[model samples]
Target chain A: MSATNLNWRAIAAIYRFEMARFFRTAGQSLATPVITTSLYFVVFGAAIGGRMGEIDGVGYGAFIVPGLIMLSVLTESLNNAAFGIYFPRWTGTSYELLSAPVSPFEIVSGYVGAAATKSVILGLVILATASLFVPIQILHPLWMIGFLALTALSFCLFGFITGIWAQSWEQLQVIPMLVITPLTFLGGAFYSIDMLPGVWKTVALFNPIVYLVSGFRWAFYGNADVAVGISLAATLGFLVACLGVVWWIFRTGYRLKP
Target chain B: MRPILELDGLTKTYASGLQALKPTTLAIREGEIFALLGPNGAGKTTLIGLICGLLRPSGGVVRVAGLDIVEDYRRARSLIGLVPQELATEMFETPFAAMNFSRGLFGRPPDHALVERLLRELSLWDKRKDRIQTLSGGMKRRVMIAKALAHEPRLLFLDEPTAGVDVELRRDMWALVRRLRDTGVTVILTTHYIEEAEEMADRIGVIDKGRLILVEDKATLMRKLGSKQLTVQLQERLEAVPEALARWRLTLKDDGHALEYRFDTQAEENGIPALLRQLHELGIGLKDLATEQSSLEDIFVSLTRKAA
Candidate 1:
């Protein structure tokens, strides 16, 4: 569609509204991740890294930086996007958006755009905090930025779908806390999948987060648990899947309209 | 002149097999106040919902200024504003920010001056900086109105605008609605208060059990269906309405101290003269007599009851 045909003003309005809510609680929104990052560094980087030397030619402390950042980015992306849409639905203000001149695509763009922007900023902050604890190097700065942005965008889209599908507060928290968080932990956020036993290592390949962490780590250290191509393809595949679900939700008006 | 809004057989049936709005057709002219009257569960809100795009119609079409709401939604929606029944708003935001947000959400550019003018018009300019949650209920309602008008829509819907407001605030809302009409904005409001319709509407529609039973000019409706009552103060008290006055359907009132007769305004013969002659012949002296026209509330109640 032509840009003139789209409602750019509406899109910006929604985006700014969501971003304003985030800024209103900026202290709490930023503090939780920063504090969590610090605890992770103190426990894993300082305590554990001193005992376990290096993996794949990178220092133990530096090897976990990319994984830790991915974990935070993934969780934050899901939460920020889900809560952004969910709060409006809960409060009944979504009626304005639904009745406005905005298309479904514009609505998604405004909400997911704000959510991804927030997650990306949090990821960068965590990276900075990680640098304070350990020396970090980036072998492919451009690719690293690409993976970070793509991951954030893809997860935010997924979170948007979750927000629409969820009928209650419990339902909204279920997927992000129980499903995504556990998957990130089991997918190698703390150690390389190669360190697992034969069967476990093969099983870890099925977890999508492993590919995200592998691709992100490859950008930092020039090596990965899986091939970089497969990791990029996997991330793209998840993004496409999320887009399909979001499209279906709007088309069917499942829980959005009656 | 083309109507600002046209609903051609619009209907809404929920997924649970409950038809909220039956096939209904309506045309509202520009620069007029149209009041929709209905009791609870009578599809007043449902009809508003379909026109404002809050609920999709099960069948038929809604056109706003020649644009189909479904096909040309962007243009159609741009021309309309709705203040929903619920007090749903961004409670954390100030009235100024809320108005600005609403304007932009409707695809309008930021015009701080326009927003300020709307706030001032609604008497919310002094409270512009306070959070909406902290404002009184009436002020919050005014904020809803300001938000709806911020986009400068040609057609506006106020659903139950004074549902829970005090009498004084209700009068203020009535005045506000009139001012909006003077500015050439078409106002359509659904109200349970029939007096509100009597007070302001150029036209009135009555919906019942998902069906729009009637729509007519307010003055014409009152004249056609309205009735007049004649109360006769008798010189002496009686235990019952005398059998000689049976033809007039007279009912005893004030413990038979007065006799009442109701007659349709449109009837060719009201029989008032014949009834007076009969009373005189019966030797029942008249102390006094008075006549009163029935109100819109009476007409509304009779219409809905007959439909039921």
Candidate 2:
């Protein structure tokens, strides 16, 4: 739709509302990732890096920066977007949104936009924190930004889907904790998949997070376990899939309307 | 004048096969307070949900100010404001922020002046900065009202606006509704309180078992359906209603000390005078007599019972 025809006001309203909620609990929202990133650096960067040799010409401390960011971004993007929409549904405030003049696309854009923005901010914070421990360089600065934004937006869309699909608090936490976090860890967030033996490497390739981490790592050190184009395509594919699911949810009014 | 809101054969059937709302049609004129009166589980909320686009209808059409709700939803929804029965709001946000957010969500430009006016009108100006969750129930409800009115919609739906409120708050809400109507906003409220409908509505609709049993102007419904009871106090206790006064269909009450005769208020010939004369002819001296009009509650109960 053209810009003139879109409900920019309503979209902004939702976006601002979600962002306000984030800022309201800023301490709690920002603390978890900061602490988690610091712990990762202490355990993996300092202690582990001291004994391990450089992989692909990059020191271990600097090698894991992109992976560490990917880990936090994936988790935060899913969490922020999921909680943003889920809280309204749980509190019955979604009735207002469902009845408002805003369309489905506008509603998703407002929520996903805020969530991706939050995740991106958290990613940058982790990047700065990682730099404090070890020197970091961006071999491909523009590509790094593109990858960060696309990954955050894609996961935020997925999180929006989870928010709509979830019926209770437990359901909301299940996928992120039991599924996404494990995938991020196994996707080579702390280790290069190339270090794995032949059989394990092929199995690791099935994990979508591998491509995301590999692609993001390439932006930092100019190397990747998976082809960069394939990584970008996978991220775009996930984004498109999330959009389709959201469209179907609004069209069917599943779990939203009687 | 054209209706501000119209529902044409709107129906809702859930996946569980429960027909929450049967095929129903209604038209609400501009600047009138229309009350949908029904007992609990009578599809009042369902009807409101359909009209407000909260629930997709199984089959039918809803139009707000001549705009089809489905085909032109953005414009149609912009014209409506809803205060749902539940006090659903962002608990962490202050009333001021909630009102401003709601106004912007409805596609209206920010107008602090208008928001302040609404808050003051709802007696929420002082509590505007307090978190809604910390406010009293009545205050939270007022916040809901202020939020719904933030955009100044043409048609407002207040679903059970006074369900659990105290008498004082209920009166305030009634007065507020009147003020809204005076300003030419069409108001549709669902209430089980017959007195509320009697006191506030220009028209009342009675729904039962997912069907609209009756809809009529308040005065006309009362005139046509309301009945008056005549009680004749006996000088002496009677064992039974006297056979000579059988034409009146009197019922013995108060341990045979009073005889009651019910007649339609709209009837031209009520036959009360003739019944009293017949009592005297039978040498049943009357100690006193009284007549009482049936309230809206009585009519509502009878209508629902008959429908059931």
lDDT of residue A228 for candidate 1: 97
Q: Write the per-residue lDDT of candidate 1 for residues A152-185, one digit (tens) a residue.
A: 9999999998898888999999998899999999
Instruction: Please list the C-alpha lDDT of all candidates, in the order they appear.
Output: 0.93, 0.93
Pull out the clashing pairs in model 2: none
Worst 10 residues of 1 chain A by lDDT: A249-258
Displacement of the residue A58 alpha carbon in candidate 1, Å: 1.7
B219: Cα error in model 1, Å:
0.9
Per-residue C-alpha lDDT of model 1 across residues B1-308, encoded as one tens digit per residue? 99999999999999999999999999999999999999999999999888888787899999999999989999999999999888888999999998888998899999999989988888999999999999999999999999999999999999999989999999999999999999999999999998999999999999999999999999999999999999999999989988999999999999889999999899999999999999999999899999999999999999999998
lDDT of 2 at A225: 95
Q: Candidate 2 lDDT, tens digit per residue, B266-308? A: 8889998899789889999899999998999999999999998
Flag regions of model 1 displaced more than 4 Å: none
Q: Stretches of candidate 2 above 4 Å error? A: none
**TM-score for the A chain of candidate 1:** 0.98
In angstroms, how far off is A254's CA in candidate 2? 1.3
Residue pairs with backbone overlap in model 1: none
lDDT of 1 at B118: 87
